[model samples]
Structure formats: structure tokens, C-alpha cells
Target chain A: MAATIEDLAQAVFDGDSRKAKKLSQKLLDAGEAPLDIINQGLMGGMSEVGVQFKAGTMFVPDVMAAAEAMSAGVELVKPLIAHEDIQSLGTVYMCTVKADLHDIGKNLVIMMLEGAGFNVINGGVDVAPEKIVEDVKELHPDIIGMSALLTTTMLHMKDTIELLKEEGLRDQVKVIIGGAPVSQDFADEIAADGYSPDAVSAADLAKSLVGAA
Target chain B: MYRTRSLYTTAGFQVQQHLFWQMLTDDQCEAIVSTAEELLERTGVEVLSEAAVKVFEEAGCLVDGSRVRIPSTKIQWALRNAPSRVTLCDRKGNRAMMLENNEAHWGAGYTPTEYYDQEKEEKRPFTLADVEEFGKLAQMLPNIDFATQGGFPTDVDEAMAEVYAFKTLVKTTTKPIVQHVRGLAQAQPIYDMAVAVKGCAKELAFDPFVALHVSIEEPLQLSADALEVITFAAEKRLPVIVSNELVSGFTAPAESAGVMIVALANSFAALVLSQLVSEGTPFITGGFFTNNDTVNELHPVGSPEVSLLGGGFANILRYLRIPSYGFGGATDSKISDAQLGLESALSTLCAGVAGTNVIAGAGVFESGLASNPNLLVLVDEMACETERIMRGVEMDEDRLARGVIEYVQPAGNYLATKHTRYYFRSEQFWPTLMNRKRIDDWAAEGSLTLGQRTMNKTKSLLVAYSPKALKDDVVAELDKIAG
Candidate 1:
């Protein structure tokens, strides 16, 4: 019997973590591969939710519930997926800059990044520039994401990027910045790789930059 | 009843009078009035509502599509009907007349910008409990005269959330509330809640005792949702505090004068629309103007020019015979540190002296990203002092020389005089935290920064405070909705 995508998609859409795990497991047992389940089930369901979210047809809670469901499905199939397949996508390191402890934007990026199947290292908030550079050096992350909600702290993003350039590591990794005060022009002026207004778009930019999409 | 006192020091009064003198000469003021007339005649503000446009057209305004050219006569007519003094209502059926003509009133405000948390991957829906708690905190604090049900409660259903929050706030505190509603569906509910709290019926609620916070993105292009809210609130005869935020480069020309003109045009447009909706709805016209720094392209409120613009706008609002709203305690700095304090104090003092009716932006941080309850406690102290400064000292001939010299000659010290005993408390604001202990006592307690002290104060308030319990029936209804 051909397993319809709707059953697997419904499990993710319903935010039923238990059913999502079971459905993905059943799909794999029925001979569908793990990558197929991720591409057609988890990613597909999340994409639909993102559209609804942007259109205001659904709100933040709806998106959160849907993300939870997709995360559940991803958890079930993660062990079955090969390391080589997972490693195909590049890594992204994200953090809110120092002296700014707020983290709603950073968390949204993490959710979107994980849903998009990228390896994400969350450095959390008020992250010092030295720590970010150290993480960059050790992790050799392909992309570094920085966020600053305050206009005063946003200057720290510029300082971190300057430090990276001085260390001869600017060319090694792509840097993307976003927050309330950050704009596309500001990102361009700061000479960063990109800027996204919101989290889902940030995921799209991250994937495109790394040639994962 | 508390008697209002002048809150001005000589230094503060001189500083504002000088700025006002520099910004507007008689000729310059006349020029601005002429420019406003030109704008009305030539460009005319767009009236999105068909009925509002027709009202203007019938009053001899030129209509080109949605834009209605408000002739000088129409502007004069609208201003003539606008009340110079309005009684804003409190929760307990008491009222305060915010004199709108020449005199300014001072009141403390709470900033409402922190509800969006893009970083935490979580948006907390601020509940009715949060609103009630905030109101209780405001009530206990000596700083605030008015309370805005704490900014953006996350738990609220956005469609009609503010109505519930305002209802909760009115029940919890006696302070006059700054009622704000954002969407169309919320208008009727907010009106109903206000009437119920004010103990009035749908027919007689036109008491001009309740204050409604009305905002517009542009003068002519009001938010469709906000307009509905204003209309519903105005029908109850509430005084509309029509305010606008003019981003120098983006919203208006980069020139300060241009920005002021545009803000004035926008404010007047709102005033006209409000009047058209309900003829005698009292109005407060004002704008929040801060230039975008060309170097940073970020709007910082601390610059001297920004202060000048705010002062000028306050003067303009007074000239138009309406009360005004001013930004108080706002700073570009992210952290709740020295930068926040200096910027907040300077900007707030400028607006307070310029005779603003309601001053906001207190206790906010991260350029309005975060609202720390501790910062609020500190800012309230500043507001208390600022209000003392706004009430200018009486200097009439009899009070100035007679008792002062006679008492001083006899006693050699005014300490024993009745005037000193009567006016000491009125002369200065007693701070809650600033002078808590002597130097040696403070040293024994370990020198704590204001931030630390504020944190302690916030925690104490949060722990000790109990909000007024919602009605059992309303609580059950809300619980069912929450589920």
C-alpha cells in the first residue's frame, strides 16, 4: 500500500508529538527512507505553517504548536538518518550580542533553523564577542548569526564584525545580523553577508547562503 | 482633593522659556499657521472614511479623492468647537480637568513597547492578572498620576484584548487610566467596559471625563483599526489624546520645521475627524518628534534638536488650544544604566517644562524594548520631582516681598515662619529611593547602584502586592475563553 503524505503531514500539523513520532516510524518501517519522511512530511508541514503565519491566518501560538509537531517527527527519524546525509548541510552559530539579554528573535531563528534541517549552535544572549569568535574558530561554522534588540547594543554587532576582520577570519565565515534596530541597509553598511526581517526568512537566507537549498 | 502646585525651579523655567523663545517668534508662529493653512488648502489631508470626507466637504473643504482640503475657515471652525478644559475620569468616578488653553498639566506615563520578544522564541501573553498587578504597583507609587494598563499583555486575544486589560486596570486602581484600543472589533467592548467602570449608560457616557489614547501613522491615513477604536471611545464623550510619532526622515522631511508642520497637519486632521464623529469630544493634540541621525540612521531622543522639536510641538499644541502628550524618560541606550538616566531626565524635563499634559516613556529600556518594574520605580521618583517643577512658583507682589521681609526681619530665619511650614512639602518632591539613608548608613548597607535598589524594590512589590480580584462571573468567563 502506498503511504499517503497527508497522514504523515497531519501528524505534524496536529502538534501531536507522540503520533508524529509513530507516523514517521511507520513510514520508515513501510520502506520509505528517512530523508523522504523529512523532506515530504516535516519540512512540508512547517512550510505550510510559515505561509499561514505570514498571512495572519495563523498566529504565533499556531506556528509554535506546528513547529513542535514537526520537531517530534524529526526526533523520531534522526537516529535512522546517516551522519553523512546530515553533514551535507553547513552549520550556523547564532547568538544575541553582549549587554542585550533579550532572546525572542534568537529562539525563533533556532526553531526555523532546526526545522530547515541545519545544525544550529545556540550561543544564547549577552554573548561576548570573544566567545563568539572562539566559537567561530573552533566550530568552523559556515554562517554566524548575530542579533541585537537595542539601538545601543546594536553597535556591538559592528564591533564583533570588526574584530573578526582584524583577526583575518572575516573571509572565512559569512555573518548575518538582525534585530529591531537592524535593517537591510545597516547590514550592507556593516558589510555582513545578509539581513532577514524575521526568523523564517532568516532560515531561507541561511540555506541559500550555504547552498543547502 | 489634592491641590496642584507649580513644579518649576528658576533654572528649569528659564531653560524652557529660552528654548520656546528661540523656536517660535511671532513671525515664525504666524508663518507656521499660514503653512498649515496652505497644507489644508493645497494638499488637504486624506479622509479614508467616506462619511468623514463628506462632513469636511459639506463644511466647504475641497475634496480630491480621499484627500479633503481643510480650508482655513474649516480649521478655525474645528478649533473653535474644541474645549480648552476637559475633565478626565478616574476609576472611582472622580475627574481632573486637564486645562488645554495656555496652561499645561503634568502626569507620569508608562511605555508600552516591550511586548514583542523576537529573541526568546516565546511571546508571553500578558494576562488580566498582569494588568491588575501593574495597576496596583502604579497606585502605590507616588510618581504616576495616570496608569496605562501595562504594555502589550501576551495572554490577551489581540482582537479585543486591550478592552479586558483596561477593564481589569479600572477595577484595580483609582488613577485616571490612559485607555488605548488598537483594532475594530475591540472598539465596542472597550466602550462598554469604560461605561460600566464609570457607572454610566450608553446614552449619558458623553462626560468628557475619560481619556482615550489615539495614534495615527500619518495625519490623513489613520489606522483603520485605530479609527474604529477612537470612534467608539469618542461616542462616550471621552477626551481624545491625539498623538503622532513623526520619524524625521521617514515620516516627514528631515528639517525640524517640516516635521513639525507635518505632525501638526496630522494632529489637526485627527482633531477634525474626532470632532466630525462627535462635535464636543475634547481633544489633546501632540507629536513625538526625533530626528534620525544621518550618521547612524537611528532615531535617538537625546539630541538638543530633538528636545527643541518636542518643545516646539508642545507650544504648537498650546497655540491650537489643545492639551498635549510628550515623551518622558525615553533613551536610545539599551541597558538600564547612566545613559538611560541622563537621557530620560533631560528629555522628560524639557517636555515637562514645555507644559505637556501627559508625559510617557518612563521605566522603559533597550530603546523601549524592555519594561523593567525597577526602572519604573526610579522613573516615578523623577516624575514626582518633574511635576513639582512644572507647577511654577507664585511671584505676585504681596507674596514676594511682604511676609518674606517681615518674617525674616523679626526671626532672622524663615524656619519659624508659617509660609515655610505650609509650603515645604509643596516646594519639593520627597524621593522614595534617592535619599533612603545617610552616607554612613548607606555605607554600612553596602553601596548599591540604583539598578540594584530598583531590582529589590521590584521584587518586593511583586511579592507583597495583591491585585483586586476580578468579579467571579467575569473570571469564569475569562477562564473558559482561556481554555
Candidate 2:
């Protein structure tokens, strides 16, 4: 007669977004603790998704679907918890660097980070160094992430970091970079705080950077 | 992978039916043909050559100034008249290659103006000797089945370049040659030269050793040079390849299907003209589908779009029962490196699996401006690998080898079995350029990279190999023609 939190977990695992959101609202309104509904219901299903993904039983689109469903349920549960009580991995400001219009990889990284409980501000594509610096100053993110698919535009990642230094904001923010042409050596040469080869690893590196892993 | 059952017969050869792939279904292919026919009827192609425009006008096509808008019935008639299979012969005039369905054949590549000179370690203009060397390389490479103009020799006059290249290629290689000449001036002499080698015009025409390639300018402009070449090819009963590079973001529509519509219309127009000139003339059709990259603003032959466009074109051409031409083993990298290997491998593999006939570009690279014999050797190895992949596994009872498996059950090895001995060569891909040795053993043998090994092999072949020389009379005849 009553829909339990186990049904909510099953909804998230099955990627049923509407059912998961409805069940989440139903449970929270029924006086279930907000964090309990998250850790045991939403994250409970997402953790199984992560395990199956690493076990090769699931694929990228599958993980993305599960992530979307979890996010849908989380959207209903969040804001009910106190501001400081909710644990976020970190805040990341992300954009594709100047003169490059590619954003497929950047969008995937954002989805992955958001799925992993990180607060991400999407800066979109073709962002110049000056504009990126202004966004960083205003957003006050814990980490800044940059993406570029072209070799010419990847150099702008360095320029953005240099401009951040010139603006005296480099010391306060950790910078990470990813793209087809951006390598780990390139990250080190440009003094990037981190380099993730793919969207899945970007989440792990973000969690570790914020000391949340 | 070998089968004995025959599905169709043409040109005295029985073609086996294999499970070849197509990028489009039957309905999609028919839709493309319909759209292309409509394009021809509505917005016609510009026939800059007055002679070609007159032919189109006399055939009841709408002629507005230089533009010729053709009817769908004329195109359908041309499709029926054009031979589905165009058989090519070797230097001796024995049928060798049957270009039907997805019978893929590898050849030496797109004409290059410059070449990598290993001795000087620099890229420079090609000499006449370089053209001869390319012919020799094509003849020597086991997997390379035919020859195309590999380089434009700068030492020769621009007017005489095609003639001289043909003379060298005819003398050095026994394989079928494809000529993309400037006009009838070069094409005529080359045909006469082939007649001289083959002994008579009638015999040469019947079992043609060469095919004429005509380039239709992008956005549908057929120049006098292209028309003259195609006309000559049709009258002589020689096969002709009507092709163009429909580069997306430049000469063609951005979407693949939109580009396909243009490609089909352009080549179909040429086919119509050829059929009108002489019914039952053999025609091969395709578009070198590629993209003009945003970074370089050049149609990079190695890009993935080349494979995509080539595969789709091949599928549609096969649906129409026409042979197709495509590209493979070309690269965008300026030098031989990991990028070169990756691009060449993927493109060649795609061409192989898609069942494209006459896949060219063995050595040409740097967006098709340079040729490297050493790189060609590396590509030849990749071609071998691709061929092995094309020879898919046999699933019949003998190949199932249940008996051998049961005998060698539970962590047993089949290395010394008779089944392994009998099937290893056909099943495994043997590479010539790839080094597969232990690190210490490799270092002991001088730590040769693939490039170094390719150079050694190329130089050794050039030094030790030469095609059997032409008869003294034929040589004098060729000299007179070249003069």
C-alpha cells in the first residue's frame, strides 16, 4: 500500500526519472529524513550503477541515464536540508577555452561532475581568457576547469591561467584541463592542478581535489 | 573465407556472393537516386565545354547557355547502358581485375607534386626517375594490385608530364594503369602507346590495360579537358572513372546525405554523356568524400569523413550495380609518425570492410601533396593486415574443429597441431614492416624503427629490382610518341 525508499532506489536504478522524483517528494513529505533518502535511496542506486559501470556490465549512456534519474530525485530532496548540512564535493567553473567551439567533451565532464554531487557552473564554449578571469572572480569556485579540442586554442588555457595570476586570483583556485589535444604532460607544463583523460575520471579527480574522496 | 558458389556472372568471371556491408538500405539508395535525378532536371550542371553542351542539347536535354539540365529518363537509360562490371587486364592483355560489387583492389595513389627524399632527408619536386621508381614500387609491393599516377614529374614540361609519366608507368609495371590527363592531347598519345605495347588497338580495347580518369569540377562544372578525356575514353571502348572530391564545408553540403546527392548527380551526368556518345560504354563512379578541415582549410584525405563518404558512395554504387572508386592508406600528418599510422590504418580498414573497389592512395600524404615510397611500404603492410581481416572466418564443420578442440581440451595448446599448420597462413596476418621482437633482441639487431626498416626495404628493392625492359621496337615507338 505504501511506496518505500527501496522502490525509490529501484526507480533510480532503472533510470525512471518521473517515478524517482515523485517517490522522492512522496517520502520527504512523509517525514523521512532528507539525507537518509539521499544516501540510502538516491546514492544507493547510483553506487550500484558505478559498480556495474566499472565491472563492464554497463556503458556510458547507461551511466548517463542513471545519473540523470538520480539528479531528478536529488533535485526534489535538496533545499530541504540546511545549507551547511548538505555535503557537496566542490564547486567547479568550466568552459571551453578561447577560439575553440568544441564542447562535447566539456558537456560530458559537466554531466559527470554534477552526477557525482559536485556543484558545477557551466561557462559554455569559446570563452576568452579575459572573460574567464572575470567569471572566476565572480563565481569564486574552488576549481577552474578548461577544455579545448584544437592545439591553437589549448594554448589559451595557459593564457587563462596567466591572466588569473595577473589578476592575483591564481593562488586561490585550482585549475584542471581536458580535451583531445590536452595531455598530462601539457597539464604539468601549463601548471594545471589536475588532468583527467575522460569524463568518468574527471569526477574522481574532482572529489580528491576537494578532499571529499 | 573462400567459397565456390557463384551468384552472378559478368565479363566471363563468376563473382561469389559475400556478406558485404552497405551504408544505406535499398530504399535509402533509391531515394538518393531520385533526388540526384531531380537535381539534374531542376538545377543543371554547367558544361563549360561547347562540344559537351551540344551533345546534351542534341539528346533533348534543356540547354540554357553553358548549363545542361538532363531528364531522369536519360539518366535511367544511361544507367542501363553502362556496364556493371569493367574488367581490366595486365600488360599481357589477360583479364586480371574484375571490378564488380565490392571487389576491392589496392593501387598507388593520388598525384603528388613533391616526394620525400630519404637521402636528402627533405621533400622536393619529383623527377622523372621518381615516377619510374613509384611504378617499380607498385609492381614490387605484393598487395598493391594496380598503378595510378603517383607523382607529377617537375623535370618534364607541364604539357608533356602526363605523357612521360604514362611511358614510365607502362614500361615498369605490368598492372593496370589509371590516367587522369589534362586533355585529349595527353590521353590520345597514351592510348596509342598502350596499343604499341599490346600490339593492336582492337586487342587493347577488348582487354583494356588502362582506364581514363576524369575530374568534374566541384559544384558541377565539367571543363573541356574533362569532357575531352571522357569522350576519347568512350569512343575507344576504354573504362573511365568519373570522380570528384566533394569536400564538405567547401564544395559540398555540410551533411553527408546532402553531399551524397551532389556526388551522385555529378557522376551520373558524366555517365549519361558517355552512354549518349556510345551505348554500352563502361563507367566507374564515386566521390572522394572528405572535409575541408577548419584548422587547415584543406580537404584532408585522412580525415574520418573520407571513410564515411567513400563507404556511403560505395554502397549506393553497388546498389546501382556500378563499380566504385575510393581512397585508403593516405594521411594528413606531415611526416611518418603515430598519426600517420593511425590515419592510414583506420582509413584502409574502413575501405576494406565497406567493400570499396579500387581503393587508391598507398603513399600519398600531407593532405595529398607529397608521396613517400617508405611510407608506401608501411601502408602496404597495413593493406595486408586489412586483407586478412576481409578474409573472415569460416563457420563450417571443418573450421569448427571440434575434434581438435576436444583433443586439446583443458589448458592444452594447439601450436603443434595439424589444423594449426594447415590454416595459420590464411588465418593470420603477416606484417613486413611492423617489428615484433623482444626489446633486448630488437636492440641487438640495431633497434630499427618501422620507418628505418621501411627505408631499408625500399632502397633494397629499388637497387635490386627492375621490370623486364620493353622490346627495342616498342621503346623506339614510345620515344617517338613522347617526342
Candidate 3:
């Protein structure tokens, strides 16, 4: 018997990445539409994970694992779906700011944004402002998120925003900053568009920023 | 519209067994008792009051001027005369506390000179208003068994502070109080106020609402003022708490055994005095122990030595079958920070484990110089934690969870089961000021620290509080006496 789309969704919900990939392959082999598989199967499971995570029934690692399964399943169907039909809430270019090697907080935000149906370009750790600017210009992402953990490294958030202003790309995207030391006051002082104290709130800030934009 | 009421009441945690932290052996305790008896016969105790000396003289002890040498037989006779268990009843004649066995009750300490203002984050001299507020706050806290005279208020007349503090406390709180007075003169008015609230002196005597605290001056001296209070309290049949503060290496011997001997001996002297004043009087006595800092010479309230000595003395008191009071939940930290938390929690847990009845100094900080209302809430939570720790482990049929275990075998979760729902809340020690929330949720709640949360909780509780009103006649009489 052929595995159904619901089975793929259940695999994603259970955070079974290998099973999700196998099920996604099975669904694609059965001649199902890749967009329908993503929207109805992968996103279907991920939306529930989002709800559970917000309700505190599902913790951070659980959501991260589920998002991993979703990403793996999405990867399997990416070639099958047309570029224009890849449905996401928005595109977000995210990174840990320059001079800071911290990636855990930034990675959490990426996972949370991906779980919320956003296409997150994870410009990984030790991300320079020039590289972010180049990627943002190329990707035309709707939102940009930055993270820094140390009080000394947090000033790089201001430097990154200043570089964005210098590149005349500050107004194009909604900028957000986060980390332990980054407060809402610091965000305003640095002239970033928004601030979030934690990963979940970072994703929510992205969604609302894109919505308002 | 129909009103709906919930059928089941919430089941809160109740600590079962008393935690016994006995550091001294039976032989060691007996040795201390005999040594104390020898000291009573050899060095003797200085009876500052002539009446107290006469009472000792009549008891057939050697009375040489103010020094009355008591025989071991008299000490034994006094110990036998005092009741082993004393109940400090509330104003309504309710058994608020049973000071017996390893049962522990906690309350605020006596007579700190300063009060910690939470909003200002500064220490200030206490006023009469602070006493009233402390009484109300203590009454609100479930862990605080009795309200205490928090500190001597600088705003009131120095001579009348005790009376004013007592008057304010009795009117504001219905819980039993542990009061410390200036002299014997203040004891009667405080008793009169309790009697007025309690309806009569006899009922108050039957179940005394107040426990008079008298401390023996250090380095082997019993003052006349202390004897006056003890005699008055004994005659009124009120419970007297004879707690002696002896700092090791300064007022007492640096070694634990010697300190223990001196402290126990001091307590024995008071016990003898009370029994002599009135036979079979309910009395609580213990050695309140602390250590002196070698470099600074400052007496540190939360030393490990204090706990060991306190525990050893408590064991001796239990051996003698008398209720004991000792210091717990006090700190040497000037602020209610990590040091205060760590010190207060450890000391209080030690005291509770030692089974100190009516453990004092719950809210005191900076080595008993200041009292913090916020720390009071924190210490109360610590007491709740101590109770949970001392509750130890239960091994009954239901607690064994055999049925739940069989139903949910390996790889099966007990969550969402009826058994889990029934027992989960009752089994855990839930804290109010302590945060168990996630980092995100904590940040969303304004990122308040533990101390801040306690302050907010305390402020809200105090603001929303209206103590049970005293009778009009009682109020008039109290005011008259206060004036």
C-alpha cells in the first residue's frame, strides 16, 4: 500500500526526519502535487507544532526537531515544485552579527521562523555586515534578523545597521535585533526596526513587521 | 443566570515527618546536662534581682548575695516541673502552635534596629507603622506561624517603643505573637492587651497568646530585668522563651562543645528561675548560636557553626523534653541578593532539620541589624521548601504508585492519567516568588528578579490587607494603655 500525505504530515509532527523524507519521496512518486504536499502535509504538521510550542506543551528542542523534519521533507519536494509556487509567509535573511561567533540564538530564530512558514536564509555565524547586505540585495528578503550574545558584541548590531544605511538598503527591509544584552531601548537607539527578547517573539516580530510593511 | 461553584478544593502540599538533625549523641547531651548542673553548683548564676535570689534561697540553693549556687537536684527538680510541650494559642484560643517533638514553627526575629524599604532599596530606622505593617504581612504569610515585634522603632519614644509595638501588633494581627520587652513594667500592659483581646486573664493564662522572650546576658550573667519578666510571665502562667545569644570565640568558647555547654547552662538557669517563680510553667528555652568573624570581629549570624551548635542544643532541649527556640533564616548580607538567599535558605533548613520550635529571624538580614519584608517572603518560601525537604519521602501504597506503574509500563508516560492529576500538585513544593517559567515568558513578564517579584507580591498583599478589627472597648483600653 502507498503511504498517504497524512502519513508524511504525521512524520513531520513526530519529528521523524528520515520517515518524513521517505514519505515525501513516496508522495512524489505517487504523482501528488509538491505544493499540495508542502501546504497540506508539511505545513499542516508544523502549524500544530507552533501552537504546542506557544502553549508550552512542546519545548524548544522539540520544535527544532519538528522543524528539521519539515525542512528535510521540503528539501525532498523542492526540485519537484516550481519556483513561483513555493508558498511561504515571507523571506527572511537572518544571521549572528559580525565579531560574534554565537549561533544558537540565531539558529533558534531561524527554526522558529521556518516553523512559522517563512523561507529563512540562515546566513550562519560570524556573519559580516557586507555579506548580509550582498545577500539581502540578491535575495530581496522581506525581513532581516540579527543576534549577538555579549555586551561587547551587541554593539555590532548598531554597526551592521549603520552599514546597511551606508549601503542605502536600510529602508528596503524591516530590521530586527535580539540577544541577551539587546533590549528594546537598544534597538531604538541603534535605529533597528524591532527587537525581541527570545526566539518565538523574534518570529512573531518578523511576521508582524512584514504584515505592516 | 446560574452560579457555578467548583466541587473539589485544591489539595496543597503538607509535610509529613519532622526532620531531625541531631548532631549530639545521647551521651554527649547527658554530659552537657551534668556539666551544666556542676556549673550551677560551682560557679553558680548571678541572680540580679533580690526577689529572684530569695526564690533561689527558698529553693534550698546556696544564695551568696547575688550569686545563687543551685544544686543538681534543684536543676532536676526545675526540669521536671516545667511542661515538656507548650502550646502558644491565638487570641481566639485556637492551638496556633504545638511546641513539642520535632515539630517546627517559624516567625520573624526580634528587635532589629533597621528596616529594609523595598521600593527605596535602603535601610531606615523602623517606626510604629512598620511594626503594624509587619504584623499584617506576617499574618498574611502561611509559613509565618506567629507575628513578631519586628524592630525597635526610632520614631516612637525610646521608652515606650515596646508598648507601642505591642499595641499595634495585637490590634492588627489575630495570630499569636512572640514579644520582647524593655523590662517587667512593659510585660503587664502587653498581657493586659492580650487579655482584653482574649476576653479575660484566665483564658489568656489557660492558652497564653503571647510568649515572653528574655535573653540571658552573655559570659554567664542573668540580669535582674530578665528575671523580672520571667517571674511575671511565670506567675501569669504564660510561656516564657529564654533564648540566649552566645557568639563563639567572643562571649562563648570557640569550641563547639564548650559553647554548647555555656548556652545550655544559660538556658538551664532561666529554666530554673521560671520553675522557681511558678511550678509547672510552660517555658521554651534554647541556645541561639552564632560565630564571630576572626578578622572583622563581627558576629556572623548564618555560620555553619551556628547551625551545628544550634542543632546540638536543640537535641539537648528535646532530650530534656522542653520546647526550644533558635535563630533561622537570618543573613549577614546587606542586601537581599544571592548571598542573602543562599545564607538564609541554608540556615533555616539547618534549623528546621534540627527541629527548632518557633525558629526566629526569618526576615532579618545583615547579621540581624536589618529586617527586609521582601526577604521575609523569600524566607517564607524557603520555610515551605524546608518543610518539603523535612517531609522527606513517603512510602505508602498510594505513593508507591504500583497501580499507575502497572497501567503505564516501560515506554509509557504517566501524564494525562487520573493518578497524575490527583497526586501531582500535592507532591510538589510550589513557590510563588521563585520563577520556574521559561526565559521568554519571564522576559515577557518584564524580566523582574526574584527579589522584585517578592517585593511586588508583598506590596500587593499588604495593600489588599485589612486585618480583623479589634473590639471598640478593647481598642479604647489599648489606646489608653498605649497613651
TM-score of each candidate's B chain against the true B chain: 0.82, 0.94, 0.95
Candidate 2 stretches with Cα past 4 Å from truth are A1-213, B1-19, B118-120
Candidate 2: how close is chain B to the reference, as a TM-score? 0.94
Tens digits of lDDT, candidate 2, B16-67: 3444667799999999999999999999888878988899999999999999
Off by over 4 Å in 3: A1-213, B1-16
lDDT of 3 by residue, A1-213 (tens): 898888888888877888999999998989999888888788788778777877767655566667778889887887787878766888998898888887767887887787677888988878888888899889999888988988988888888788889999999988999988888888999999999876777777888887832
Candidate 2 yields a Cα-based lDDT of 0.83
Give the better candidate number (2 or 3) by DockQ.
3
The runs of at least 3 residues in candidate 1 whose Cα sits more than 4 Å from the true structure, single-residue gaps closed, are A1-213, B1-26, B97-130, B202-209, B294-297, B301-306, B396-425, B459-483
Candidate 3, what DockQ?
A: 0.03
TM, chain A, every candidate:
0.88, 0.85, 0.85
In angstroms and one decimal each, the interface RMSD of every candidate reads 28.9, 19.7, 10.5
Ranking of models by DockQ? 3, 2, 1
Better model by TM-score, 1 or 2? 2
lDDT of 3 by residue, B1-483 (tens): 011223244355455555578788899899998998899899988888899889889889898899888889988998899999999888677999999998888888777889988678788887888888889888899998998877778898887778889898888888889998757878888888888877788889887888988787576678888889888999999898887888888889889888878887777878888898889999898857878898876888877887788878888999999998888888889876898888889988988998988788888878888888777778889999999988888745566676777776876655434466456666889878889875656998999988889889998889888877888998998888777
**Between which residue pairs do clashes occur in model 3?**
none
Roughly what TM-score does model 3 have, to 2 decimal places?
Answer: 0.69
State iRMS for model 2: 19.7
Is model 2 an incorrect, acceptable, medium or high docking prediction? incorrect
Model 3 gets an lDDT of 0.83
